[model samples]
Target: MSMIQTNDFDHVNLIEKVIENNYMTYFNYDEFTNKLEFENSISSANWNIIQNNLLINITDSENIENIIDKLIDHLIKLHDEFGYGFAGVKQIIEQNIQYINQPLLNNILDWLIKNQISSKYIFFHGFLYFNGII
Candidate 1:
């Protein structure tokens, strides 16, 4: 009986593991324009690294891409009348736009452009333009 059983490294399993590991990590925002803060054991830097790595991996894995898409949509749906729930997520996305796939980023940008007039996301437009992502 070998204590260590070797199995093929599975990308789908990795994706699912990552998602499940972070599922309970919630968002917290004290102020806009600041880096996203999470109310969990993971530090902001760790979360940023996790997100960056995840987004980078998503470019190669359709499973990750689909899961991330659904996750973003679910986050958006969690927004309240004042749009509190996912603002931090948006901030993180904007700051880490380079890691995101072009099409997904475009969709996010389109949503931002459409809602900029009345939403906090308006603050990100200039940043994106300055960063040349817009």
Candidate 2:
């Protein structure tokens, strides 16, 4: 029998990372753009971590439905509270769900709909949605 570990703290750490990079301290357009670029890099790195973790469970044939459900739930909460720029995060999530046959994909989409959360909330949603993760 395999057991699933609830890594709420890990999720919290991810949220903190998002919050730490999403805000502007000053109003320099160039600086703001640079900061956003940096934040995008960090977000990519975080998504890699999340993807690796999910791959591990997929290899093990462990049920990841709960894990994905919790992740989306946490993300929605973070967005609602902090409005963190979640474009990268949403991209990663959409990709993973499309590439992997996970039951929790439906849960994620459901949560997004119920919360009225859209890819538009994230800065890169326009590009991503045009590419079709709307």
Candidate 3:
């Protein structure tokens, strides 16, 4: 197993650095890549590394913009790559709505509308209503 999988090594800083540098970083990627991996890129796998290794240990002192924004960017890229095959990204967005600010949420929802996915329009309407943003 790699040092990252063993959890005995100090990989937090390394992971954080990777996240700041590339929002598309994934544990499965053998190298830091600038392009999105269509076959292996799933929201759950990416989120696993971030949520388990990085966010869980974050302190209040940490500037979380890079981490959150990177994940958001990654998800958006995934949408761009796969189009309607967005169930994974949708789940991530729904669960993370509370963590993101209104502007970022607007960006995400706007992208969804631009895609013209009927279900997403219905979904975001409910999201806005339930979150008291309507």
Candidate 4:
């Protein structure tokens, strides 16, 4: 019996697998310069918009694009609210949502999770570095 099994790999899935298998990209932010460093060319406005959108969608969206579309909403939020904070960040990862501190948001995510939004869609922060093919 062969332990290894091969499967077809789609383009985006390949990218995801690469990101999942590799080391996480550490983003650098220059507060004085309003600059963020990562592999993607995400700007400040786009980043905020993306973060806001992520917060908006991660709760209820099931589509991969819709979910990934709004990834990493709290990188800046986390950075702003808690600079270099690991406990809060770890909580977000553990629960797959930002607003664990907020009861209303927590309830919303709880409802969404009960409805079947898998962490596969809701919990990916790796898009921070992945420059998706436009």
Indicate the TM-score of model 1.
0.30
Count clashing residue pairs per candidate: 0, 0, 0, 1
Candidate 1 per-residue lDDT over residues 1-134, each given as its tens digit: 76966554443455446558984344343322334333442223222322433232344345533534454543354343224334444554454455667776666667666766643355555545654547
> What TM-score do all the candidates reach, one by one?
0.30, 0.28, 0.24, 0.25
As a whole number from 0 to 100, the lDDT of residue 69 in candidate 3 is 42
lDDT of each: 0.47, 0.45, 0.46, 0.40
How well is each residue in 1-134 modelled by candidate 3, as lDDT tens digits?
Answer: 65635543234545456567975433455323354333343212233322322212223343444433454455556467534234445554544555666665666556554644465455554544564543
**Models sorted by lDDT, best on top:** 1, 3, 2, 4
Model 1 pairs whose backbones collide: none
CA error at residue 76 for candidate 4, angstroms? 3.0
Q: Which stretches of candidate 2 lie over 4 Å from their true place?
A: 1-68, 74-84, 102-134
- Model 2 CA lDDT for position 87: 56
Show model 1 residue runs off by greater than 4 Å. Answer: 1-95
Over 34-129, each residue of candidate 4 has an lDDT whose tens digit, in order, gives: 543334632231111122322433544355444433434454465565452444354443344443235544444444445445654344333221
For candidate 4, give the lDDT of residue 70: 40
What is the number of residue pairs that collide in model 4?
1
Q: What are the RMSD figures for all models against the true structure?
A: 17.4, 17.5, 15.6, 15.4
